[model samples]
Target: METLMAVVIGVLFACAIYMMLRRSIVKLVIGLIILSNAANLLIFTVAGMTRGAPPLIPEGLYAPSGIVADPLPQALILTAIVISFGVLAFSVVLIHRAYEVVGTDDLDQMKDTDT
Candidate 1:
């Protein structure tokens, strides 16, 4: 499973980079979204794959006993998700506004207008 996830993450990262290299503003935003998702998956995969109960310590115990899933990765993934969402939203709004002002989504055209 971990190996599979690694492969998937690699593919996602490659795709994201390809999209980001495109000359379209919209594709750039899409690439950003994909990059964020790939990062999240990488974090998850590096944290190890385990199937067990939630990390809940019994009364009077300092740590969870026996086989228990790690909470840190889950927390990290959740935080990343929220942050990515915010970035995506902001990027989309910025792109829309840029499109309206520049009247084009092509990066080359947008660059020409800077003068």
Candidate 2:
């Protein structure tokens, strides 16, 4: 399972990098989302795969006879998702504004407008 996650992370990283290099704002935003998901997967897999229950335990702090997931990685993924969502939303608004003001999606032309 870890190996599978590693492969998924690698593929997501590659696609994210490729999209990040593109000239459009939408692709860049997608790249950012993919990068976040890759990071989340990497964090989860590297923490070890545990199956049984949620990190939250009502049976007390002790092991209590069940294998539970590591809470840290879960929290990390949640924070990452929240941050990525905010970033994605902001990017969408920014992209719309850019499109309205510049009339084009090309980064090269956006840069050339100053000169």
Candidate 3:
């Protein structure tokens, strides 16, 4: 499973990079989204997949009694998801405004809009 996930993550990263290299502004945004998802998957894959109890202590115990899921990686992934969503939303809005003003979505064409 881990090996499969690693391969999938590698493919996603490659696709994201390829999309990012395109000349279209829309493709750049798609690449950013793909890159963010790949990052989240990488974090998840590195954190180890285990079916365990929650990271909580029993009533009288100071620590977990058995194997417990690590909360740190989950927290990090959640935060990253929220942050990435906000960034992607902002990017989409920015791109829309740019399109409206510049009348084109091609980066090469946009270069001339400033003049």
Candidate 4:
């Protein structure tokens, strides 16, 4: 299970980077989203694949093996999602304005527009 999750996240990261290199601004934005998701998964995986367990220690308590999954990763992901959303929203607006003013979605063409 852990290995599978790692592979999945790795694939997402690879795809994200590949898309980020595209000539289209839209693809770049999409890549950013994928990258953020991959990062979240990474944190979750590194935190251990096991569900939450008792944190308290008692005299030979022999606490239960599993209780619930940790909520920290989920919370962290929420923050990441919100941050990514704001960035994506801003990028969309910027891209729209760029397309309107420059008449092209290509980053190369955008670069040449200033001259």
Best by TM-score: 3
Rate residue 102 of model 1 by lDDT.
95
Model 1 lDDT on a 0 to 1 scale: 0.94
What ranges in model 2 sit over 4 Å off? 55-63
| Tens digits of lDDT, candidate 1, 1-96 | 988998999999999999999999999999999999999999988999889898888999998899999889999999999999999999899999
Residues 1-115 of candidate 2: C-alpha lDDT, one tens digit per residue: 7788888999999999999999987888889989999998998898888775775646556554567667888888899899989988999999999988888888988887753
lDDT of each: 0.94, 0.86, 0.95, 0.87
* Candidate with better TM-score, 2 vs 3: 3
Global Cα lDDT for candidate 2: 0.86
- Residues 1-115 of candidate 4 have per-residue lDDT tens digits of 9999999999999999999999999899999989988998998888778856545546677753446576677788789889989999999999899889999889988898873
Would you give me the overall lDDT of model 4?
A: 0.87
lDDT of 2 at 58: 62
lDDT of 3 by residue, 4-109 (tens): 9999999999999999999999999999999999999999999999979999888988889889999999999999999999999999999999999999999999
Model 4 misplaced regions, further than 4 Å: 52-66
Q: What's the lDDT for residue 111 in model 3? A: 90
Clashing pairs in 3: none
RMSD of each: 1.2, 2.2, 0.9, 3.8
* TM-score: the better of candidates 3 and 4: 3
Work out candidate 3's RMSD over C-alphas: 0.9
Model 3 error, position 84 (Å):
0.4
